[model samples]
Target: MTQTVPQTTAGADDIQEIVERILSAAALPPIVQAGHPALRQRAAEFDGQLSRDQLDRLIGIMRQVMHEAPGVGLAAPQLGIPLQLAVLEDQFDVDPEAAALRNRSPLEFLAILNPRYAPLGTGRASFYEGCLSLNGLQAVVARPESVLLEYLTPDGAAEQREFVGWQARIVQHETDHLNGVLYIDRAQLRSLSSNAEYAAHWAEAGISKAREGLGFDAGPAGISLD
Candidate 1:
C-alpha cells in the first residue's frame, strides 16, 4: 500500500510543480554538484512536504537518476531538494574477492525519510567511495562498520534498524548528506584519486596498497578493516 502526502493548498501545488519538473526526463537531469549551496546546507526534515502523487513521482525520477549515475545511494540534496530524504540500492555484481573483503552484499531499493543514524560500535572500515554529486573522483573514507538507523517509511511509520558492513557505509553516507556533510570532509585527502587513475592502478592493488602509494594513514592502526 502506498501512502499519499496530505494536501495543503498552495504548498502542495508548489511541491508538485517542483517534482514534475524533476521528472520531466527519464534519463539524467542536472544533479546538484559539489560546492553547490544546496549540498552545503542542512536539509529540512520531510513531513508530508510533497503531495502523494508528487512524492511518488519524485521517488521514481530519483531512482532513475541514481541508476543512471550507477551509484549506490542518493540524497535529496543531490537533486537540489533540501529535504531529509534519500533512496539507496546496491545491486551491483561485485567480484567475489572484493565482496569477501568488504562484506559487500546486495541491497534492495529503499526510500527513507527523515533518517538519522549513529555508529553501533567503535569498529570502523576504510574504503574508497565516490559520489554522484562529485563525479570522477573518489577518496578513502573511514566510517563505522555498523549503524543503528532510525527513519520513517513512506507510510510515515517509524522504524529503527541496524545495518552492517558495506550496507552500513551506504546508510551513513546518505545520512551525512542530510547533515550537510560530504565524504571528503571525512576522507583522507592524500587518498583522493580520479576515476582513471583508480582504475589503472588502485583497482587491483586494494586499499592497503593505496594507502602506501598515496602516503596517507587511514587512522589508528589495528582497526580491523577490509
Candidate 2:
C-alpha cells in the first residue's frame, strides 16, 4: 500500500516570493552561463566555519532562488557564490508509481554541502538532461542509476546516504555544480541536439521510463529538516 503524507499550506507561489526577495537582497553576481570559464573553474572554499545564522541565510536564499526559477536544482555559483553548496527541489507533480520505480519522490528538497559522490555498484542509465544555467538546451547524459554520497549538512554534521534513479541522477548533476562541472560536459555527441530533438530522442529511447517508473502513489514524501 502506498502511504501519503499530509499536504502542507506552503505553495509554489509562496516559495517564489521568498526567492525574489533573496535575489533582490543578496549581493550575488549575475548567473554565469554554460560556457563561462567560471563554470569550469572549481569553486573556492566557503571560508571560515559557517555560523548557524549564516547557514540559515544561505539556505533561505537558495530556496527562494530555486522557487522563482522553478528548477529541479540550483547551486551557490549560480547565485554568484563560489562555495561548495547547492539546493535541489524534486517536487514536480509526476506519477508516484513511476517515481517509485525510478527511485524518485514527487516533491522533495535538499540542501547539500561539500558533497562527494561515487557510483553505487555498477550499471548506467542514460537520460535527457537540462540545466538552469543553460536554460534552452537539453542533452542525453549517461550516469549511474544509483550512487552513494557523503556530505556535510547545513549544521556541519556529517551525513552519508545512497540514492537511486532520477533522484540519484539529480544529485549527480547538482554535485557537479559544486565541483564546477555542467551536464554539457558529459553530454553524448548525438544527444547534444535541441530541446525538441532531445525530447524526441529520449522518448524513442525509453528515457521517460525513469519518470514513469517513479511512484507518487504514496503520500507526500518527507524532506530532511536538519
Candidate 3:
C-alpha cells in the first residue's frame, strides 16, 4: 500500500499567536516553535495554491521575527512548520569585495518554496554560526561558500540561481532547516566559542577558513556570531 500524507490547513489565529510569541520572546524560539500540530508533525506538499492572503501573512510574520531576532534567514521549520519554505534577508551593508563575490545586488529578502540545492564543489569553509532556535549559543560550522539552488516562488514560478559568499552560506543554513538539520549538528567543538572569542580569533586570523576552501576571501565583515 502507498503511504499517504494528510492534507493540512493553515489557520490565521493560530499562526498569528505563534508569530506574536516569537516577536515578544527575549530570544528566538526553539526549533519547531509554533504552528499547528500538523505543521510541526509533517508538512504537506505546496500544491501551488497558496492564497495571496496566506503568503502575505507568512511574509509579515517571518519579517517581524527576523527583525526582532536579527537573523539573516528563517525557514518554515523554524516556526514549527515542515513546509519547504523559507525567507532570507541580507541586512549587512555591502563591501566592494563582498559584492564582487556575490555578483548580484544585495537582496533585501527572498521567499523560497520547495527548494533544491547543490554544492558548487566539494570544498567547505569554516565559519562561526548561530541560530535563533538554539538561543545564546554559537559554533564554527563548515559550509560551502557557493551553491546552485532551484526553488519555487510564492507565486509558483520556478526560480534557479547560483549564490556565492554570504548569500550562499545563508541559503545553505536555511535549507538545512528544511531537512531537519541545525548548524550545531555540524559544528566543531573547539571552534564553538563565545561570540567575542570567535570575533577575536577571526580578526587575528584575518580570513575565514570557510571562504578559503571555496576559493574565495573572507566575507565582507565576516559572519556575525551574535
Per-residue accuracy of model 1 over 126-159 as CA lDDT, tens digit each: 9998888898999998888999999998778999
Model 2: weakest 10-residue lDDT segment is 216-225
Order of quality (TM-score): 1, 2, 3
Return the top candidate by TM-score. 1
Alpha-carbon runs more than 4 Å astray in model 2: 1-30, 47-50, 95-102, 196-226
Clashes of each: 0, 20, 2
Against the true structure, candidate 2 has what lDDT? 0.65
The digit string of per-residue lDDT tens for model 3 on 116-193 reads 788898766655677777666676666776799998888779999998866887888787666555676566654555
TM-score of 2: 0.72
How well does candidate 2 score on lDDT at residue 30?
Answer: 45
Per-residue lDDT tens digits for candidate 2, residues 73-167, read 88876764556778888778767665565666653778888888998887777666788788768766778888999987787778998888888
TM for every model, in the order presented, reads 0.87, 0.72, 0.67
Indicate the worst ten consecutive residues by lDDT in candidate 3. Answer: 217-226
RMSD, every candidate, angstroms: 7.3, 12.8, 8.2
State which candidate, 1 or 3, has the greater lDDT: 1
Better of 2 and 3 by TM-score: 2
lDDT (C-alpha, whole model) for all candidates:
0.80, 0.65, 0.63
